[model samples]
Target: MWRCALPPLPRYPTVDELGARAAALVARHPRDARLRRVGTSRAGTPLWLLSVGHGSRQALVVAGPHANEPVGGATVLRLAERALADPRLCEGADATWNLLLCLDPDGARRNEAWLSGPYTLGNYFRHFFRPGFLEQPEWLPEGADGATLPETRALLDLQDELRPFLQCSLHGVDVGGAFLELTRELPGIAQRVARTANRLGIPRELGPYDTLYWPTLGPAVYRIPPPRRGDLAAAITEAAVESTWFHPHPYGTVTAVVEAPMWGVAAVEDPTPPADADAALRTVSHTLRDDTRLLEEILARVRPLLGCSPDVARLLAPVDDYLLVGPGLADSWDPDLRQGGTRPLPPLTVARLTALRLAGRRVALRTAGLLHQLVTASGHDPRGVLPELDRLIDEWCADYRDGCGARWIPVARQVEYQARVVLAVFDLAERDARVRSRSGETGWGSPAAVPMHRE
Candidate 1:
């Protein structure tokens, strides 16, 4: 038996705690790890990057780029610890992998408070808000007027100095499960990632660029248009002009913005598995170990060809545009959000009713199913209340629309639509026999609903 020495998993740490923990781990590890102060947040928190591995000129740029997406940070930290503890993993991989983890300290910190608490639906809704492009330290809008945040500047400097072969910006979403989107030049890499997720029983999907509900600058990038800005994408494009002043790397760079939904992992665990703290720790460790192995295998296939692919830049052009433009209801030609601009919200149709409702139900079932799988994978049956909850959400949206009349539906309509459905599910889980019998033991309630405020 390879006795695992991993400690019991703690609740997700806050950004400050996570950074401190990462620093301590790096300090304790065997490898020569150096911490670099990359930049500072608007709040003045210092953003740090840990550099490990020695010899190969190639760099593996990985960052928990999104604030709420903490798993990637956890994964990177764990992977670093493992790599340091066992030299064998890095024996042939030395110098070639300079990992840049946690690029957004401010965002990460903002998310930490929620992570330390109970992982409930209400908690997530209350705390989670995507940062706008200008809000992001890495993004520079046109005519910034000398308002560059420190974190952004540091990242630019790091990019210039390191000039890594690949940049992997780790992000996560609330919907759509586990999938990888890469430059079309790296389709094989995406397929490999999808296959790995599937092998682990993680829900996987593809074609994120084409299937996004709204325009996305990149796969995971979200941009908010400026007030009175008619051409959202054009404004973004114009904003990019300011980015030229901060170009860090002389060589063209290809960035892959990856969004790994936490639901993917939440969905696959054996619901009824042993709850003994020690046993749970072991189970999670083993699961992560297996995941890492799969990732390494996929990387092995992609690493060798990065330098020689002449079309890599060309293939990445569209991806770059997508990220820079940030998805919107508008596009390059039309950016106005008011004039039913470029990317109008996905038309509210019966089709969306079906998709949104299906999604809501699946999420509910997946939550219950995950717990069940963790406890007992074989006889697992997610409670039936989720279906009813889904129906309620669909009906609520339909009713609301009918009452409000057709020509225009506010963005708040969609937010309320999702929230109402979530609330219905939580309510039923607390009362219904099927849901009560399984998840009722735990008092999971919706977070206090915040009324939409319109001026």
Candidate 2:
């Protein structure tokens, strides 16, 4: 096992720091490492592609696919530093590592306020900013009119240029347990990754699964469901297609998404079934509905007073989505009382999941904060619905922090777990490739060839 001795990062790097650090890594190893300007962000910030080593097999690692998930940015720099320090890392896999540093710089900058943290729920939601799902670069639908972001274009261009065999997008959650989602079930990867997380004391995310609809391979590991064009379920939720499904490689790209939590608590991984599981599930549904209703009520009041500020528009986008679709989503969680034999969730699992939903509610209310800012930015008093907005924001932040028992997961530990599993997957891919080569098999590893773990 390659032990990563990552020094504790005191705070997450700012957008400027991330760029400078990436450049510094390339400068340190001029011969083996090269940095190129791939595309320009919407805000005119440069997008960088850092290449380490010159092996034939191409692997694309994307950091900051979503703006708020900044942990991956550090992971990229560390991995690049490791590769540059020891050529054998890439040499062993016979792979050239292409790292996209800060894929969504525009949104990332909006989130920079909380990046270097007093990593708390209050600080996070106070400075939080996430564009709507459609606005997200990774999930922008193909050729949507005036919808494709420049960041998305850069990613698509790079994917086409590299024709990579493996692509890994680093993603993290605000408060929950850790989990991994792969485009397909690659052999002998999930178990190794899960076991490593266990050894590192990072509990496997057992509840409120981000990939709840996907097929599960094991605890905390899931196979992403195939994206069907115009799926009714997705349409109802206004969910966009994931970037993993859009690879242009003829050999087929195996995409892995690694999610770690920013905050930690015991209940996220508790397995004991709840005493009244059905009721617990109902509480989850009710809580989300109530939060959604609150946001809707606030938005309705401020809608008439709002202006055309781009920042306000960006912040409001997801709020609109949630309000439009949140009801259906909350309703989707309702357990079928009519169905007799359905399994019930554990009490702690329900608590943690509810807390996770509350964390999201806190994020959603950020629109109100931004709205307050926008009104004040124009030199007008933010009095009308602004006081109510401030109250809700504080109320929800407190609810999430105290109710969830949220604790900051150290930056070093997060990097360690992510780097370990990522390297493990790379090794597994190498092994799988060698096996296929021995059998005269070619393009695309078959999903049915091997199970994710030994039964």
Q: Kindly report which residue stretches of model 1 are placed more than 4 angstroms away from their true locations once superposed.
A: 1-10, 60-62, 85-91, 94-96, 143-147, 207-230, 233-253, 264-455
Error of 2 at 67 (Å): 0.8
Q: Using Cα atoms with residue i matched to residue i, what is each candidate's TM-score against the true structure?
A: 0.51, 0.87
RMSD of each: 23.4, 5.2
Candidate number of the best TM-score: 2
Per-residue CA lDDT of candidate 2, range 1-455, in tens?
A: 43334454667777788788878777767888898999999889999888999887778899888888898888888888777667567886677889988888888898887787778776676677777767778774654233467887788777766766678889887777787877767777768877887887776676544555556677677787655566533642423353544453234567788887787655766666567656765766777678778767766766666776776677777667656655655565567542445433333454345544644464355655555555555565444665666787787667666876667778878877887777777776666666665786543333333333322
- lDDT per residue, candidate 1, 1-455, as tens digits? 22213442455445665577667766665456666677777678777777666643334445656565665555455545544555543454333344556667666764554676665444443344335445555455633335466666666666655654344455554443444333212323433443444454444332232233433332222232222333445533333233422232223223444545543322221223333433333333343333334323432433343343423332223223333333221221122223543443343322222223223333232222222222222232233333433443344334323421212212122222222222222222223322322553311111111112212
Candidate 2 scores a C-alpha RMSD against the true structure in Å of 5.2
* Top candidate when judged by lDDT against the true structure: 2
The whole-model C-alpha lDDT of candidate 2 against the native structure comes to: 0.69
Global Cα lDDT for candidate 1: 0.40
Report the alpha-carbon TM-score of model 1 versus the true structure.
0.51
